[model samples]
Target: MLTYYPGKTFLHRLDPTLKVLFAFTISTACFVFANIFVLLGILLFEFLLALSCGLWKWGLRSILGLLKLCALLFVIQILTYGDGDVLLRLYGDWVITFEGAEIGLILTLRITASALPLALMLRVTKPTALANSLYRYLHIPYKYAFAFGMAMRFIPIFAEEMAEIMEAQTARGVELDTRSFFKKIRLLMPLCVPLLLSSVRKIETATISAELRGFGLRKRK
Candidate 1:
């Protein structure tokens, strides 16, 4: 789950606005530089920084958790990049090539490089602090800031719920393991309705609570 870790690490101590800016800057750099080496360097730099902050455990877990997604992207690249030195043939008229593989690797690295910084930041920074920083420093409307904060807080909550749901499904003999990402998605789609209903119920409860706490009165002051 991508949630804040309570610690006095450098990233934790850094201003929330600065952390947001730093994450965006790194993410932007990842997209701007298409070179695999640069992407690797950026990723390595992020890991080292996370390690220094004692948050590499969470960062690595988040990154490794996404390897399947990266593999899917790599597969897409191999299938679509029709022209290059033929590397391997999987079937009739479908093949892998050196350039395709290279491009796929770069595409994979690009996405990973873009995502890790933001994920690491979320781990080290509190959602409330971030929202407040956005309001206090940037003068964003209170409601928008509150929405952002609540979204950050709930992302991990829903992720945990989904994990539990998947576990429950597995216990019931739902074969969740599959080589094809699309097949995995198809298998899991049935649970989405329940998850969505749960999310709506939570949102309704939050709305009631917010109303009781004078949610929109903050803008008056």
Candidate 2:
């Protein structure tokens, strides 16, 4: 689920620290620019740079996902707190303020603009490279860094397990068609229980292994 593709893009060539700095700088600019037009200009520039790095399709898809999430949030905000001018009053008196709608839109755009480039950076940068860069620049402990690396690696493992479990249940004539949402959810409980148990066991084993290996020991030299 989380793997990097090798490429000769300039982003791939830059030092990891520089790439992170660039992402942080862009994120800061997004927050600092209160005007939507200026924030959009920065987002457009980021899109161009992402395209230059040979990941245009990936970047665009991620940005679109952000847009959808933001749109959903805006809808919820309008429905719940919308008042003044009265864009269809619901249940009586609860109104969506024009100011509130504008605030929501600006906030959504700012968050999306800030997050998309950082995500793109993650997509292009490998986990090992990121961990090493963090260790070198931020003085992060290797144990914690390696744990983060392992956690990212496990995402696909758990996903594959879930898919296999779903397929097995489907083969066994378990109708998960969701005609009854609650029933389908109940069926998922069995799968979830075992998965949770396995995850707990894995965590316990890792902790014990770390203890045996003197993971907390500092170098005497």
Backbone clashes, candidate 1: 0
Q: Which lDDT tens digits does candidate 1 get at residues 60-178?
A: 87677666679988999998887889999988888899999999998898888899988888888899999999998888897899889999989988998888898889889888866
Which consecutive 10 residues in model 1 have the weakest lDDT in total?
A: 59-68
Per-model TM-score versus the true fold: 0.85, 0.76
Q: Write the per-residue lDDT of candidate 2 for residues 1-221, one digit (tens) a residue.
A: 24565677898877777788889999998888888788778878888887987878877887787888798788777776654565454566777777667667777789889997677777677777877787778778877776776676566677777777877887888876558968988888788876777777877887899879987686422
Off by over 4 Å in 2: 80-94, 173-190, 201-221
Clash-forming residue pairs, model 1: none
Cα deviation in Å at residue 81, candidate 1?
A: 1.4
lDDT of each: 0.87, 0.76
The clash count of every prediction, one per candidate, is: 0, 5
Off by over 4 Å in 1: 88-95, 164-187
